[model samples]
Target chain A: EAEVAQSPRYKITEKSQAVAFWCDPISGHATLYWYRQILGQGPELLVQFQDESVVDDSQLPKDRFSAERLKGVDSTLKIQPAELGDSAMYLCASSFGFNYGYTFGSGTRLTVV
Target chain B: EDKVVQSPLSLVVHEGDTVTLNCSYEVTNFRSLLWYKQEKKAPTFLFMLTSSGIEKKSGRLSSILDKKELSSILNITATQTGDSAIYLCAGATAGTALIFGKGTTLSVSS
Candidate 1:
């Protein structure tokens, strides 16, 4: 079974430092999503992309966070000047279409000191 | 604001016990409901329910969706220690991202 791929399973950095996470969705998937899961809360959507084009980023904190999928394949999420509250598990998922089931990546756990 | 809610924030069960997790949603346009199991990292898909009345089952796990009630239930029978994890429920609307609930943390002891 094909699975979504993520890099740097764990990352720890000091506050105000920059951090980036990478994700490669299942091959041929057209839609990709990035989510942040807090320690005791459910995962919240940060952004959604359709073929490299951002579809929804209403919840993304653009002032400090940025994401890109130039080729509509792999994606990268960066947080500039990370804050202590930014500590969480970052998950990525993808689907062939809006109605299809999604496959998730192992996720990158971020720890800000 | 669309959202999903799960009940019994936590559960404790022993091996051979049956457990039921609940999920409810309040979305403008309902498309599908999905359940996932999160151990330590990412969540793994368990079920996707799009229709009402029809139950989806896999091995010892089963799920059913009720569109009218805006709720779903996941049942795990003959639980084992490996069943300990956080179970997530998510709902999606037409052409929109999935919204997740807080999840239920289930601890299946020996």
Candidate 2:
């Protein structure tokens, strides 16, 4: 089966440093999502993208986080001045539409010291 | 706000045992309920329930949704050690992203 790809399986950065994560959704998928999972908790939505346009980002911390999918295929999420509370598992998922089941990437585990 | 809640945050069972995980939701404009299995990395899709009274099954696993009750249940029969993982339940709404529950951790020992 086709899979969503993510880079930097693990990352450890100092507080005040910048961190970035990348994701490439499965071919033909038009809806992409970014979620953050804290230890012992379920994943929470950070942002959602439809093709190249953002559909929802209400839960994203705009003050320090930004995400873009300029080509409508691959996406990038960046956090500036990472905080200790920012440590979590960042997951990327994609689907043909909201009604379809989503395929999740392996995810990037981030840790801020 | 919209939310999904799972019961018995953790469970322990032995091989050949049957286990049931519960999930309840209070999402506005609810569309569907989904279940996933998480081992170490990302969660793997298990089942999706859209209409009530329709049971979805796969091998030894099965799930049913009750819209009237605003809840769902996942049943895993003859559990194996490989079934040890965190089971997550999520609720989908017509207007927003999925709302996930804290997840139930299941440990099936030999």
Candidate 3:
């Protein structure tokens, strides 16, 4: 079965540096989601994309975080001038559509010191 | 605000014992309830319940949803050491995103 793919399963960086995470959704899946999960907590949505356009990014920090899916298949999320609080597991997921459930990637664990 | 809550944040059971995990949610427009199993990495899908009082089962795991009470339960029977993992419950709203609970951690010992 096709699965969502993510790169750089782990990352470590200094505060005030820049970092990026990448994700590839399941084949033919059109809806993508990015979420942040802190230790001992559930995942929280950071953004959502429908095809190549963004559907919702209300929880994203526009001042420092950005995400894009140019061709509607793969996506990248970037954080400039990362803060210590930005340290968390960044998860990527995709679904056939809103009506279907999601499949998630192993996630990228970011650590800022 | 939309929220999902899970009970018994942690559990410890012996092999062959049964366990029940609970999840409750409050959302504006509930669409579906889903269950997942996480074993130190990505969460794997288990079940999705969209209707009330309907139970969905898979092997040793089963889940049921109660839309009227906005609650769901995941049951694992005859558990084994492999069944030790974190169980997460998520609620999706119509035309919206998913809201996940903190999850219940299950540790099945031999």
Off by over 4 Å in 3: none
DockQ in order = 0.83, 0.77, 0.80
Q: In terms of lDDT, which candidate is stronger, 1 or 3?
A: 1
**Residue A8 alpha-carbon offset, candidate 3, angstroms:** 1.0
For model 2, state the Cα shift of residue A12 in Å: 0.7
When only chain A is evaluated, what TM-score does every model earn?
0.98, 0.98, 0.98
User: Using lDDT as the measure, what is the rank order of every candidate, best first?
Assistant: 2, 1, 3
CAPRI category for model 3 = high
Worst 10 residues of 2 chain A by lDDT: A94-103
Task: Give the per-residue lDDT digits (tens) of candidate 2, residues A14-100.
Answer: 999999999999999989999999999999999999999999999999999999999999999999979999999999999887568
| Candidate 1 DockQ, CA atoms | 0.83
Off by over 4 Å in 2: none
Task: Report the lDDT tens digits of candidate 1 across residue range A1-113.
Answer: 89999998999999999999999999999999999999999999999999989999999999999999999999999999899999999999999975577899999999999
Question: How accurate locally, in lDDT, is each candidate?
Answer: 0.93, 0.94, 0.92
- The lowest-lDDT stretch of 10 consecutive residues in candidate 1 chain B is B46-55
Two-chain DockQ for model 3 = 0.80
Clashes of 2: 0
Error of 3 at A112 (Å): 0.7
